[model samples]
Target: MTRWTQAAVLARMRQEIEASAPDPGDRLPTERALAAAIGCSRQTLRAALARLEAEGEIWRRHGQGTFRGRAPLGHPVRETVRLQAATPEQLMQARLLIEPAIAAEAARRASRSDAQYLLRLVEDGRVATSRGGAEEADARFHRGVAEVAANPILIGLLDHLADARRRAAWQREWDRTYRRIGVGEFVGLHSDQHQSVVTGIAEGNADVAEQAMRAHLLTIATAMRRGSDPADPGL
Candidate 1:
């Protein structure tokens, strides 16, 4: 039997995460199972896992076993194979259907700390220096709302939507839309909308939060549809 040191066990655990749960937020094998597979004592395996958790390479919940990924947004990724290939139009439709409800739930569920975190994300977008930075802040703000909702399933859904938003088809459409609207739209219009949602959430007003989220998404839809009229080419 091989005697695995703690460092060796840690390395093996990382290998297992990379090999088996390649996606961030995917769950890992149970501790007992991992110990057996790595040929290490449970003590050594436990030590290795603690190191990973401390480093934010993984996270654990009380009844939920260990999972791959960092401190925040540790919800497991859902199987979204078909959605990944969905058209940009369909993705926006799905977001319209679900995201408002998620925002309402965030308002209902958010603690003071959660609300503060969301404000930070909103501020990050407002102060962003570049288009790419603003887009990233926008993504984090949306995901941060789902995190405040305190539901793993909803967070996973948002994660998939976020992933779909990154597809090349979505990027092409978004870039065209953004070129028309420019960074000013991000700094002015979208940031104001995001601030409204955060305010509603902070005030614990579910209806306001829901309505604000829908309005924000609709504004994006309007932007996307702007140039579709070939005669106007609204750009």
Candidate 2:
């Protein structure tokens, strides 16, 4: 029997992911099955999966199985697949309009438990070591705030916005920008802003929540602008 090196195992697993050709939101098979199919131990398979996730080749939800590609910021990629693609500015503008209001409403309506949940999301963002992990927390934080507002209409709308982030063109642009801006710095800045938003919501100050969220979005806009000139036809 051949002793499979971890690097070799990882290469094989990646080939499988490509061969399977799962859509962005499609979940891969269980570890046991994948390991069996690849003739590797579960521990080896998990390591390969972790590397794939860190490289933004795949994502994992807390309860959901591992998904095939980078998770979108706002909505499931499947939801946005049929919708018309949005420009980066359009996506940012939509968030500016919707998210601040959601934060304000959450401040007014959130119970103590709800505030705790939001804080937990903040902590998740702070501790995230990979771009995909930070992004997952970011998406869940926004969705969590919307959920706290108890507005289904806004929730559905936000999902569309989230899904837009997963567009191949959009992700490529974001990736290019982040490569220029430094992913670690970007994640750190985002984590700080996340804490502010949570604090504003937990304090039940609608104005504070609105301002915090607006400021946070503006900071992100600034980073995006710094990374890519919106007027560039190539973008």
Q: Tell me, by lDDT, which candidate is best.
A: 1
For all predicted structures, in order, the TM-scores are 0.65, 0.62
| CA shift of 146, model 2, Å | 0.6
State the lDDT of candidate 1 residue by residue for 32-122, as single tens digits.
Answer: 8887788888888888989999998987765556766764332233333354336678999999999999999999998999999998898
Give the runs in model 2 whose Cα sits over 4 Å from its true position. Answer: 1-83, 230-235
State the number of backbone clashes in model 1: 0
Whole-model lDDT per candidate: 0.82, 0.78
How many clashing residue pairs appear in each of the predictions shown? 0, 3
Range of the 10 consecutive residues with the lowest summed lDDT in candidate 2? 77-86
Off by over 4 Å in 1: 1-81, 233-235
